[model samples]
Target: MDRIQEIVDFWFLPESDENYGKQREVWFKKNPDFDAEVRGKFLEDFEKAEAGELLHWSESARGSLALILLFDQFTRNMFRDSPRAFAADGKAREIARHMLSCGFYDELNTVEKQFAALPFEHSEDMDDQKLSVKLFEELGSGEALDYAQRHLEIIERFGRFPHRNEQLGRESTKEEEAFLKTPNSSF
Candidate 1:
Protein backbone atom coordinates (compact mmCIF):
# COMPACT_ATOMS: atom_id res chain seq x y z
CA MET A 1 0.00 0.00 0.00
CA ASP A 2 1.04 3.61 -0.47
CA ARG A 3 2.29 5.64 2.49
CA ILE A 4 -0.94 7.67 2.64
CA GLN A 5 -3.13 4.57 2.70
CA GLU A 6 -0.87 2.92 5.25
CA ILE A 7 -1.02 5.97 7.43
CA VAL A 8 -4.77 6.34 6.97
CA ASP A 9 -5.44 2.72 7.84
CA PHE A 10 -3.13 2.92 10.80
CA TRP A 11 -4.77 6.01 12.23
CA PHE A 12 -8.35 5.00 11.43
CA LEU A 13 -9.44 1.43 11.91
CA PRO A 14 -12.25 1.14 14.51
CA GLU A 15 -12.67 2.13 18.15
CA SER A 16 -13.54 -1.37 19.35
CA ASP A 17 -10.09 -2.82 18.80
CA GLU A 18 -7.37 -2.77 21.49
CA ASN A 19 -4.69 -3.42 18.88
CA TYR A 20 -5.16 -0.02 17.29
CA GLY A 21 -3.30 1.86 19.99
CA LYS A 22 -0.55 -0.75 20.15
CA GLN A 23 -0.05 -0.74 16.42
CA ARG A 24 0.07 3.05 16.41
CA GLU A 25 2.60 3.04 19.23
CA VAL A 26 4.84 0.70 17.32
CA TRP A 27 4.59 2.88 14.24
CA PHE A 28 5.45 5.99 16.22
CA LYS A 29 8.43 4.24 17.81
CA LYS A 30 9.65 3.32 14.33
CA ASN A 31 9.39 6.92 13.16
CA PRO A 32 9.79 9.24 16.11
CA ASP A 33 11.49 12.25 14.54
CA PHE A 34 9.34 12.23 11.46
CA ASP A 35 6.28 11.91 13.65
CA ALA A 36 7.32 14.87 15.78
CA GLU A 37 7.86 17.07 12.76
CA VAL A 38 4.55 16.07 11.36
CA ARG A 39 2.86 16.77 14.67
CA GLY A 40 4.44 20.22 14.86
CA LYS A 41 3.42 21.09 11.34
CA PHE A 42 -0.04 19.75 11.99
CA LEU A 43 -0.31 21.83 15.10
CA GLU A 44 0.80 24.90 13.22
CA ASP A 45 -1.71 24.32 10.44
CA PHE A 46 -4.39 23.58 12.99
CA GLU A 47 -3.70 26.82 14.78
CA LYS A 48 -3.85 28.73 11.53
CA ALA A 49 -7.12 27.15 10.52
CA GLU A 50 -8.45 27.74 14.01
CA ALA A 51 -7.64 31.42 13.51
CA GLY A 52 -9.87 31.43 10.38
CA GLU A 53 -7.25 32.74 7.98
CA LEU A 54 -7.36 29.65 5.80
CA LEU A 55 -11.12 29.82 5.37
CA HIS A 56 -11.36 33.36 4.09
CA TRP A 57 -9.74 32.83 0.68
CA SER A 58 -12.63 31.20 -1.18
CA GLU A 59 -15.46 28.78 -0.52
CA SER A 60 -13.75 25.81 -2.16
CA ALA A 61 -10.43 26.76 -0.66
CA ARG A 62 -12.05 27.00 2.74
CA GLY A 63 -13.61 23.58 2.50
CA SER A 64 -10.47 21.95 1.13
CA LEU A 65 -8.39 23.62 3.81
CA ALA A 66 -10.77 22.33 6.45
CA LEU A 67 -10.26 18.78 5.17
CA ILE A 68 -6.49 19.18 5.26
CA LEU A 69 -6.73 20.58 8.76
CA LEU A 70 -8.86 17.68 9.91
CA PHE A 71 -6.58 15.16 8.21
CA ASP A 72 -3.53 16.54 9.92
CA GLN A 73 -5.34 16.58 13.23
CA PHE A 74 -6.17 12.88 12.88
CA THR A 75 -2.63 11.97 11.85
CA ARG A 76 -1.20 13.95 14.74
CA ASN A 77 -3.55 12.25 17.15
CA MET A 78 -2.35 8.87 15.88
CA PHE A 79 1.26 9.68 16.69
CA ARG A 80 0.22 10.81 20.16
CA ASP A 81 -1.16 7.29 20.87
CA SER A 82 -4.90 7.96 20.68
CA PRO A 83 -5.28 6.19 17.33
CA ARG A 84 -8.92 6.94 16.39
CA ALA A 85 -9.35 3.94 14.11
CA PHE A 86 -12.96 4.77 13.24
CA ALA A 87 -11.84 7.68 11.08
CA ALA A 88 -10.74 5.34 8.31
CA ASP A 89 -14.38 4.50 7.70
CA GLY A 90 -15.62 5.92 4.39
CA LYS A 91 -18.57 7.85 5.77
CA ALA A 92 -16.56 10.70 7.24
CA ARG A 93 -14.52 11.07 4.05
CA GLU A 94 -17.67 11.04 1.97
CA ILE A 95 -19.30 13.75 4.01
CA ALA A 96 -16.19 15.91 3.90
CA ARG A 97 -15.90 15.50 0.14
CA HIS A 98 -19.55 16.26 -0.28
CA MET A 99 -19.17 19.40 1.76
CA LEU A 100 -16.23 20.49 -0.37
CA SER A 101 -18.06 19.77 -3.60
CA CYS A 102 -21.00 21.75 -2.34
CA GLY A 103 -18.63 24.56 -1.53
CA PHE A 104 -17.43 24.51 -5.13
CA TYR A 105 -20.98 25.16 -6.30
CA ASP A 106 -21.75 27.69 -3.60
CA GLU A 107 -21.16 30.60 -5.93
CA LEU A 108 -23.86 29.36 -8.27
CA ASN A 109 -26.41 29.92 -5.54
CA THR A 110 -27.54 33.37 -4.47
CA VAL A 111 -26.82 34.92 -1.09
CA GLU A 112 -30.45 34.22 -0.10
CA LYS A 113 -30.33 30.61 -1.32
CA GLN A 114 -29.56 29.27 2.12
CA PHE A 115 -28.56 25.81 1.09
CA ALA A 116 -25.62 24.04 2.80
CA ALA A 117 -23.77 27.18 3.60
CA LEU A 118 -20.88 27.14 6.02
CA PRO A 119 -20.34 29.78 8.68
CA PHE A 120 -18.14 32.74 7.83
CA GLU A 121 -15.55 31.84 10.44
CA HIS A 122 -13.75 28.57 9.70
CA SER A 123 -11.91 28.22 13.00
CA GLU A 124 -11.69 25.07 15.06
CA ASP A 125 -13.98 26.84 17.51
CA MET A 126 -16.59 26.71 14.75
CA ASP A 127 -16.45 22.91 14.90
CA ASP A 128 -18.56 21.57 17.74
CA GLN A 129 -21.43 19.36 18.76
CA LYS A 130 -23.72 21.75 16.89
CA LEU A 131 -21.79 21.24 13.68
CA SER A 132 -21.68 17.54 14.36
CA VAL A 133 -25.41 17.53 14.91
CA LYS A 134 -26.02 19.36 11.64
CA LEU A 135 -23.77 16.98 9.78
CA PHE A 136 -25.44 14.06 11.47
CA GLU A 137 -28.84 15.38 10.53
CA GLU A 138 -27.71 15.83 6.95
CA LEU A 139 -25.99 12.46 6.80
CA GLY A 140 -27.21 10.07 9.52
CA SER A 141 -26.77 9.38 13.19
CA GLY A 142 -24.28 6.56 12.68
CA GLU A 143 -21.75 8.61 10.70
CA ALA A 144 -22.31 11.64 12.92
CA LEU A 145 -21.73 9.70 16.10
CA ASP A 146 -18.66 8.07 14.60
CA TYR A 147 -17.27 11.46 13.66
CA ALA A 148 -18.11 12.90 17.08
CA GLN A 149 -16.52 10.01 18.89
CA ARG A 150 -13.41 10.28 16.75
CA HIS A 151 -13.33 14.03 17.28
CA LEU A 152 -13.62 13.49 21.02
CA GLU A 153 -10.75 11.02 20.90
CA ILE A 154 -8.65 13.52 19.00
CA ILE A 155 -9.35 16.24 21.56
CA GLU A 156 -8.64 13.90 24.47
CA ARG A 157 -5.39 12.78 22.87
CA PHE A 158 -4.12 16.30 22.40
CA GLY A 159 -5.29 17.20 25.91
CA ARG A 160 -6.93 20.11 24.04
CA PHE A 161 -8.13 19.93 20.43
CA PRO A 162 -11.11 22.28 20.21
CA HIS A 163 -14.18 23.31 22.13
CA ARG A 164 -12.07 23.66 25.25
CA ASN A 165 -11.99 27.41 25.35
CA GLU A 166 -15.66 27.91 25.96
CA GLN A 167 -16.24 29.28 29.44
CA LEU A 168 -18.32 26.22 30.20
CA GLY A 169 -15.58 23.87 28.98
CA ARG A 170 -12.88 25.19 31.29
CA GLU A 171 -13.32 22.36 33.78
CA SER A 172 -14.28 19.63 31.32
CA THR A 173 -12.10 17.10 29.56
CA LYS A 174 -14.43 15.85 26.86
CA GLU A 175 -15.78 18.35 24.35
CA GLU A 176 -19.00 16.43 24.65
CA GLU A 177 -18.91 17.02 28.36
CA ALA A 178 -19.56 20.73 28.20
CA PHE A 179 -21.60 20.30 25.07
CA LEU A 180 -23.88 17.77 26.68
CA LYS A 181 -24.27 19.97 29.70
CA THR A 182 -25.36 22.87 27.56
CA PRO A 183 -29.06 23.38 26.92
CA ASN A 184 -28.25 23.71 23.25
CA SER A 185 -26.77 20.22 22.93
CA SER A 186 -28.53 18.38 20.12
CA PHE A 187 -27.02 14.98 20.93
Candidate 2:
Protein backbone atom coordinates (compact mmCIF):
# COMPACT_ATOMS: atom_id res chain seq x y z
CA MET A 1 0.00 0.00 0.00
CA ASP A 2 1.05 3.61 -0.47
CA ARG A 3 2.63 5.08 2.64
CA ILE A 4 0.02 7.78 2.88
CA GLN A 5 -2.73 5.24 2.45
CA GLU A 6 -1.22 3.14 5.23
CA ILE A 7 -1.27 6.10 7.59
CA VAL A 8 -4.82 7.09 6.63
CA ASP A 9 -6.07 3.54 7.05
CA PHE A 10 -4.41 3.04 10.42
CA TRP A 11 -5.43 6.37 11.86
CA PHE A 12 -8.96 6.54 10.46
CA LEU A 13 -10.37 3.18 11.42
CA PRO A 14 -13.93 2.19 10.61
CA GLU A 15 -16.36 4.10 12.83
CA SER A 16 -17.91 2.20 15.74
CA ASP A 17 -18.11 2.57 19.49
CA GLU A 18 -15.16 0.25 20.03
CA ASN A 19 -13.10 1.78 17.27
CA TYR A 20 -13.78 5.27 18.59
CA GLY A 21 -12.34 4.28 21.95
CA LYS A 22 -9.44 2.56 20.26
CA GLN A 23 -8.74 5.67 18.23
CA ARG A 24 -8.80 7.76 21.37
CA GLU A 25 -6.43 5.35 23.08
CA VAL A 26 -4.04 5.39 20.20
CA TRP A 27 -4.20 9.14 19.78
CA PHE A 28 -4.48 10.31 23.39
CA LYS A 29 -2.80 7.63 25.45
CA LYS A 30 0.95 7.38 25.23
CA ASN A 31 2.10 4.03 23.95
CA PRO A 32 5.80 3.47 23.41
CA ASP A 33 5.39 0.90 20.66
CA PHE A 34 3.01 3.01 18.63
CA ASP A 35 5.24 6.05 19.01
CA ALA A 36 8.30 4.09 18.02
CA GLU A 37 6.55 2.65 15.00
CA VAL A 38 5.51 6.07 13.83
CA ARG A 39 9.01 7.38 14.37
CA GLY A 40 10.67 4.52 12.54
CA LYS A 41 8.25 4.04 9.68
CA PHE A 42 6.95 7.49 8.83
CA LEU A 43 9.45 9.92 10.21
CA GLU A 44 11.21 10.24 6.88
CA ASP A 45 7.96 10.84 5.09
CA PHE A 46 7.02 13.39 7.69
CA GLU A 47 10.26 15.21 7.18
CA LYS A 48 9.66 15.21 3.47
CA ALA A 49 6.17 16.46 3.92
CA GLU A 50 7.41 19.24 6.14
CA ALA A 51 9.87 20.37 3.52
CA GLY A 52 7.00 21.02 1.07
CA GLU A 53 7.98 17.97 -0.98
CA LEU A 54 4.55 16.46 -0.56
CA LEU A 55 2.47 19.30 -1.97
CA HIS A 56 1.29 16.91 -4.63
CA TRP A 57 -0.60 15.01 -1.97
CA SER A 58 -3.11 17.82 -1.78
CA GLU A 59 -4.49 16.92 -5.18
CA SER A 60 -7.11 14.62 -3.66
CA ALA A 61 -9.20 14.70 -0.52
CA ARG A 62 -7.78 11.58 1.13
CA GLY A 63 -4.27 12.57 0.18
CA SER A 64 -4.78 16.02 1.65
CA LEU A 65 -6.24 14.47 4.81
CA ALA A 66 -3.26 12.15 5.09
CA LEU A 67 -0.93 15.10 4.72
CA ILE A 68 -2.76 16.90 7.49
CA LEU A 69 -2.38 13.86 9.73
CA LEU A 70 1.33 13.73 9.07
CA PHE A 71 1.72 17.35 10.10
CA ASP A 72 -0.84 17.56 12.90
CA GLN A 73 -1.34 14.09 14.39
CA PHE A 74 1.82 12.08 13.71
CA THR A 75 4.09 14.90 14.81
CA ARG A 76 2.36 14.94 18.20
CA ASN A 77 3.07 11.26 18.82
CA MET A 78 6.46 11.12 17.14
CA PHE A 79 7.90 13.99 19.10
CA ARG A 80 5.74 14.06 22.18
CA ASP A 81 6.51 16.51 24.99
CA SER A 82 8.84 18.60 22.89
CA PRO A 83 8.53 21.77 20.86
CA ARG A 84 9.10 19.60 17.84
CA ALA A 85 5.69 18.11 18.47
CA PHE A 86 4.20 21.38 17.36
CA ALA A 87 6.72 22.29 14.69
CA ALA A 88 4.41 21.34 11.89
CA ASP A 89 1.31 22.98 13.26
CA GLY A 90 1.43 25.95 10.91
CA LYS A 91 1.75 23.71 7.92
CA ALA A 92 -1.09 21.54 9.11
CA ARG A 93 -3.27 24.55 9.66
CA GLU A 94 -2.39 25.85 6.23
CA ILE A 95 -3.35 22.58 4.62
CA ALA A 96 -6.56 22.49 6.61
CA ARG A 97 -7.44 25.97 5.43
CA HIS A 98 -6.71 24.91 1.91
CA MET A 99 -8.86 21.84 2.31
CA LEU A 100 -11.72 23.96 3.54
CA SER A 101 -11.36 26.57 0.82
CA CYS A 102 -11.02 24.00 -1.93
CA GLY A 103 -14.04 22.03 -0.78
CA PHE A 104 -12.05 18.88 -0.07
CA TYR A 105 -13.11 19.02 3.55
CA ASP A 106 -16.70 18.36 2.53
CA GLU A 107 -15.79 14.94 1.19
CA LEU A 108 -14.77 13.54 4.54
CA ASN A 109 -16.86 11.53 6.98
CA THR A 110 -17.47 12.77 10.52
CA VAL A 111 -14.29 11.38 12.08
CA GLU A 112 -12.05 12.52 9.27
CA LYS A 113 -13.68 15.92 9.34
CA GLN A 114 -12.89 16.21 13.03
CA PHE A 115 -9.24 15.44 12.39
CA ALA A 116 -9.04 17.72 9.43
CA ALA A 117 -10.25 20.49 11.71
CA LEU A 118 -7.91 19.55 14.55
CA PRO A 119 -5.05 21.75 13.44
CA PHE A 120 -7.40 24.65 13.89
CA GLU A 121 -8.59 23.32 17.23
CA HIS A 122 -5.06 22.83 18.45
CA SER A 123 -4.10 26.35 17.50
CA GLU A 124 -3.71 28.92 20.23
CA ASP A 125 -5.05 31.69 18.04
CA MET A 126 -8.58 32.69 19.01
CA ASP A 127 -9.73 32.91 15.40
CA ASP A 128 -8.60 29.40 14.64
CA GLN A 129 -10.13 28.18 17.87
CA LYS A 130 -13.46 29.75 16.97
CA LEU A 131 -13.31 28.19 13.52
CA SER A 132 -12.63 24.85 15.17
CA VAL A 133 -15.72 25.20 17.31
CA LYS A 134 -17.80 26.06 14.27
CA LEU A 135 -16.43 23.09 12.34
CA PHE A 136 -17.12 20.71 15.22
CA GLU A 137 -20.66 22.03 15.63
CA GLU A 138 -21.31 21.46 11.95
CA LEU A 139 -19.91 17.96 12.21
CA GLY A 140 -22.45 17.31 15.00
CA SER A 141 -20.21 15.26 17.24
CA GLY A 142 -21.02 16.15 20.81
CA GLU A 143 -17.68 14.93 22.07
CA ALA A 144 -15.73 16.93 19.51
CA LEU A 145 -17.87 19.97 20.11
CA ASP A 146 -17.23 19.76 23.84
CA TYR A 147 -13.52 19.47 23.33
CA ALA A 148 -13.49 22.27 20.81
CA GLN A 149 -15.36 24.54 23.20
CA ARG A 150 -12.91 23.67 25.95
CA HIS A 151 -9.94 24.45 23.75
CA LEU A 152 -11.54 27.71 22.68
CA GLU A 153 -12.20 28.66 26.28
CA ILE A 154 -8.59 28.04 27.18
CA ILE A 155 -7.38 30.19 24.31
CA GLU A 156 -9.89 32.86 25.20
CA ARG A 157 -8.61 32.96 28.76
CA PHE A 158 -4.87 32.41 28.35
CA GLY A 159 -4.18 33.09 24.66
CA ARG A 160 -2.41 29.73 24.61
CA PHE A 161 -2.55 26.24 25.99
CA PRO A 162 -1.03 26.19 29.46
CA HIS A 163 -0.59 22.44 29.21
CA ARG A 164 2.04 23.04 26.55
CA ASN A 165 4.01 25.42 28.72
CA GLU A 166 6.49 22.89 30.06
CA GLN A 167 7.07 21.28 26.70
CA LEU A 168 7.50 24.60 24.94
CA GLY A 169 9.47 26.09 27.87
CA ARG A 170 7.10 28.94 28.53
CA GLU A 171 6.38 30.00 32.08
CA SER A 172 2.74 29.75 33.06
CA THR A 173 0.91 32.66 34.62
CA LYS A 174 -0.70 32.22 38.05
CA GLU A 175 -4.16 31.84 36.58
CA GLU A 176 -2.91 29.40 33.97
CA GLU A 177 -1.12 27.42 36.64
CA ALA A 178 -4.33 27.21 38.63
CA PHE A 179 -6.28 26.18 35.56
CA LEU A 180 -3.72 23.52 34.77
CA LYS A 181 -4.31 21.95 38.16
CA THR A 182 -7.98 21.41 37.50
CA PRO A 183 -9.11 18.08 36.08
CA ASN A 184 -9.20 17.72 32.29
CA SER A 185 -7.46 21.06 31.85
CA SER A 186 -4.92 20.08 29.23
CA PHE A 187 -6.56 17.86 26.59
Highest-scoring model, lDDT: 2
> Which ten contiguous residues of candidate 2 have the minimum total lDDT?
14-23
Q: Write the per-residue lDDT of candidate 1 for residues 47-104, one digit (tens) a residue.
A: 4544555454224533443444334334434334443322322322343445546665
Candidate 2 whole-model C-alpha lDDT, 0 to 1: 0.89
Which residue pairs overlap in candidate 2's backbone?
none
Off by over 4 Å in 2: 14-24
The global C-alpha lDDT for each of the candidates, from Candidate 1 onward, is 0.39, 0.89
Clashing pairs in 1: 12-85, 13-85, 14-85
Worst 10 residues of 1 by lDDT: 111-120
RMSD of each: 12.4, 2.3
Query: Model 2, 71-140: lDDT tens per residue?
Result: 9999988999899999899999999999999999999877789899999999999999999999999988
